[model samples]
Structures are given as C-alpha cells and as structure tokens.
Target: MFRLAAAAACALALGLAAAPAPTSAAERLTLTSQYGPGKPQTLLWERFAEILERERPGAYDINIVTNGALGGEKEEAEAIRLGAITGAESTIANLTTWVPLGAVLDLPFVFQDAAHIERVLEGPLGDELKAAYRAEGFETPAFIIFGARHLLGKTPLTEPGDVDGLTMRVLQSDLHVALWRSLGANPTALPITEAYTALSNGVVDAMDMTKSGFEALKLYEVAPVLTETAHIWAVGVVYFDANFWAGLDADERALFQKASEEAAAYFNEIAAEEQEAALQRAMALGASRAAVDQELWRAAVAPFVEDFVRNMEDPRAVDALEMIQEAR
Candidate 1:
C-alpha cells in the first residue's frame, strides 16, 4: 500500500513540476520608420507598443527601428516584401510597389484638407485599398496623415510659370515626376535622404515636401522660400508582412488593429500641429513664405493631368481622380 502511494505521489509531483510544458516566448514584432526617435511617428508607435502589451500581454514584444537605421523608405519597403523586416511606416509612394492603386493617393491637388482625406481614407475607398494590400501579401493596419505638401525652393514659386525650367527634386515616384514635368519643371527623382545634398549642390532647385519634412531635414537652410501650394495632402501607412500578421494570435491581431487606429488618429493631430510649428520655425530661420497662384498652377499642369488620364494604363487612377473631383 505504501509503495503504491509513493508511486502516486511521485507522479503527482512530476506532473506539477513539469509546469504545463512551459508557455512559449512571445513573438517579436519589429516596426521600422525613417523618422528619428522622439519624432511624432516614433511616439505614436511607442503608444502602439503599450497598447499591444496591455491588450495581448505575453503574446508580442514590439521593437521600433527609427531613423532609417534599417534602410531608407524604399529599402525598408522592399525588406518588408522579402520578409526581412516585419513592419514599417512608409509613404503611399512606397506602398505603390505592392499595390498600384496606392499611387492614386498621390494625385496632385486631390484633397483639400485633413477632413476630406480622412473621409476618403476611412471610408469605402480606404477599405478597398486595405483589401488590395491584403491580396498583395501585406496588412495595412492604418494610414497616418502626413500633412499637406508645400513647395520649397531657392527661387520664389508663386505660380506654375515660376517652376518652369527649374530642376526640381521629386520623390522617386512616376506620378510625382509626371506632375512636376506637367508643371514645366525638369523633375529629378531622388530619395529623401539625398534631397538635402541635391538641393545644396544645386542638383535640384526646388522640391515639394511637407513643411515638417523640410524643417526636420533642415532643407530650409538651403531652400529659403517655402510656398503654400497645398497641392496634395500626403499620408503614411503602417503595415506588416502578411505572413507575420497571419502568425499572430487572434487577441494579438485585435490589439494591433486597435492600436493602429488609435495611433493613426493621434498622429494626424500631431502632424497638424507640427506642420504649423515647422512653418513658424522656417519663418524664424529666415525662410520666406508665399501664397501660390492656384489658378495659374492648375492651368499649367492641366495638360499633364489630361495626358495621365489618356495614357495611364491603371483604371484605378482615373477612378480616383474622378472620385476626388466629385468630392470637391
């Protein structure tokens, strides 16, 4: 009787000591962005990390890589595609490589304000774009507002005619190139990292960038004239590789989704404030600000829009343009 009891006790002790096969370590999630630490985007992601931890404790540990430490925008995007990186915050232009429909967001003068942009992106159009990203092996968690684009140049650009014959640096997007060319400028596509040198060396005379971007990059030091063209409102997308997203548990996924939505909204608010502050900083630094002649600029670039509509193979491009016009 005592032997059997001892055996039973041993079994019970072993069962208890086994510790339920030891729960696996949480999956690691890494998020990369070109912006430096302490930037609004980084702070937004930091909050996202807190949300993930609180909502899905022990399920995920998020690591944020900032300041292009992994790579510049394009390289970071390519890394996500190859699964070398799990997540990133990149411009719609970068996402266009996976989904051509993304280029639709870059249509110049499409959105007048943040509210208009929010309505379009948070509505059916945004959902459709998200679905397209899913089909392309990505999970677009949220789209963050990047604020309105402005013109920064060595020479004043009050109208489209002023842009003529000027070599302007543009994002490495075909649409951006087309837009600048349409305005009569010699557009050169370069990565944001190279833009500072390009402007300093006179390789490019002007560029269309966000006010915050201009201040952050210190481009105002080189380009003293900042024009409020407000041609297009830009957005940044936070996304994860589909394979990585799929590996996340239900609770983890929910956490990410919720966190992203909240972060995006917060980012929009911060972006607006930063844009105004950047403008003030630029002005303080001796940069001049001028109002652009929208009518003249529109007339000069009308041909380019017509050409794009006529020759562009992507039907979504036309649809997006029509949608923006209707919204206006």
Candidate 2:
C-alpha cells in the first residue's frame, strides 16, 4: 500500500527491504525499532519517511535504526523524552508508566477483533488517548497496531493452566507481569533485545508477542510452538519526541502529522496480511500452531480485567475503557 514503485515492491517482501535513503540536506532525526530491516514496523518508518520526502522536501532526514540498536522500546522512549532520540513506537502497556490512560488499551479481550480495534482506536476514543499521550510528553501522531499477541513455546500452551510454572519473557510493564502472574507463569521483565538468547539458552520457557515480532526476530526458531491466544490487540503509537515537536513551526508540525496519519492508515491496512504471511513462514519452518479455547480464556481472565480497570490509578482509564466498550 506504500507509494514505492514496482521495483521497490521488495520493501514489503517480509525481510528483504531496507529503509529508503535519507533525504538530502534535511535535519537528521532518529526513528528506532526493535526489529531489523524488512519488518512491517521498519517499513512503517520507511513509509513515514517517504511521505515527508514528497511533502516537505529537504526538511527531514528520518534515519531508521533497527534491531534494538538503540535499546528496547522503553529505552527509546526515555531517550525521546530527554531529546536524545527523536522517535519510536511503543505498546500502550509500555506507555502505562507515563500515561495510565494506556491501561484502557492494554486490557485483555477488550478488543473483540481487528475490526473492533480499528473502530475504537480510529474513532473519538483514540483522539482522547492521543491528547493524554501529549499531556505526558509523548507526541503521538499515529496509532499503529502490532497485531494480537500469542504464546510461543516448545510445546502447546493452549489453556490458562498450561502456562503454570512456565517462565515467560514479558515486556517491562507491571501490568504485563500481573497478567502472567494471574495465569501462574513467572514473568521476567526483559528487554526484547535479549529474548533470543534467553529463549535459546532456556533462561525462559516461553514468551508472548505479536507473530510478526516473533518472525522478524526469528524467535520461532527457538520457540517453535505458537498458541493463538489473541488476548490483547497490541496497539501502539508512532510517536515523536515532545521536545522536537515543541521546536517545530506550526506548518512543519502539520506536515509531519499528515504524513503520520497516511503512513499509519497504510500500516493498519496491511497489518493482517503481514501477520498471516509471518505465521505461514513460521509454520513452514517446522513450527507448530495451536488454538486456544476461546470460552476458557475469556472466563479465566474476566475477573482480572475487571480488577485491573477498578484499580487503575488514572480514573480516566475507566472512562476510556467504557467508551471503547460502548463503541463496540
């Protein structure tokens, strides 16, 4: 869905495309990713860059850094706040530290399906969350999704009790920890950069992440069983450094905002295709796919979801969750 020409179609060939070259005489800015070249998010960054190139010629040189070279999403976000880095994407769970309103998005089973997610996030509720993001020093221009997360392990983990006693690698979010803890897994908060070695060396028994993330990092090579939990929708923001945004002129900010909208919409349009393709690749590589019992999972997590909303430090999170459910 990108405007790149036929010859540039390789950009979406799953791991074949690199970010386009930086524009000429443009102010250098970093757009970091926890993935390498050819991944969808990397391509999202490339798409963002191309829009800037066409609309604000010679105004920005959005340098793409992949493979957690700038550390994980949390580090990248910290750097952005310090103005040490320009931008990166982060899940709503990861943003909970600064914006408790993110809790609404992280609730399990809140999103019924991809269409439900698109309707809620692309509608008024999303705009409210973006304003919350801005209040916390994150200039979120686009809401991108990383697909739903599933468990990856050496054996099928298709039920709530199946995860008992398993060591799972999770992002550095307390909510994520609580989610796993409630399911009886000992969750380790690790930066994604170490997931491969951790899983390879048996430091962890399994992990949960989006299929594209597992495929992009080749994590399926180590954890060959993917359980389709679809518990969380995994929405995130393609955000800018608040400090950088503060310095840009109104016209400049408008240009970049427009580009973010277009690129993110394109990203959403292709998210499913990318996930399905990534799952196929993982399966072809001798990985096993398992299905979760939907009723079982829903019942198991319903109480926690309720408690989570009730205890949210930011009262706005409850309102946001209500808005999402009402929209659904």
Which residue segments of model 2 deviate by more than 4 Å?
A: 1-25
lDDT of 2 by residue, 76-116 (tens): 77767766667887787888888877778878888887778
* C-alpha-based local distance difference test score of model 2: 0.82
Q: Which candidate should be chosen as best, given TM-score against the real structure?
A: 2
- Estimated TM-score for each candidate: 0.87, 0.90
Stretches of candidate 1 above 4 Å error? Answer: 1-24
lDDT (Cα atoms) of all candidates against the true structure: 0.78, 0.82
User: What is the total number of backbone clashes in candidate 1?
Assistant: 0
Q: Which tens-of-lDDT digit does each residue in 1-328 have in candidate 1?
A: 6334444543453334332332568676667666777777787888888877777676765667676665567766666655666787778877676677777777776677888777778777788889988888788989988988889998678887788899999887778888888768999988788888999999999998898888888889999888988877787788888888888778768877899888877878888899989888878988878887777766766777667766666677677667766665
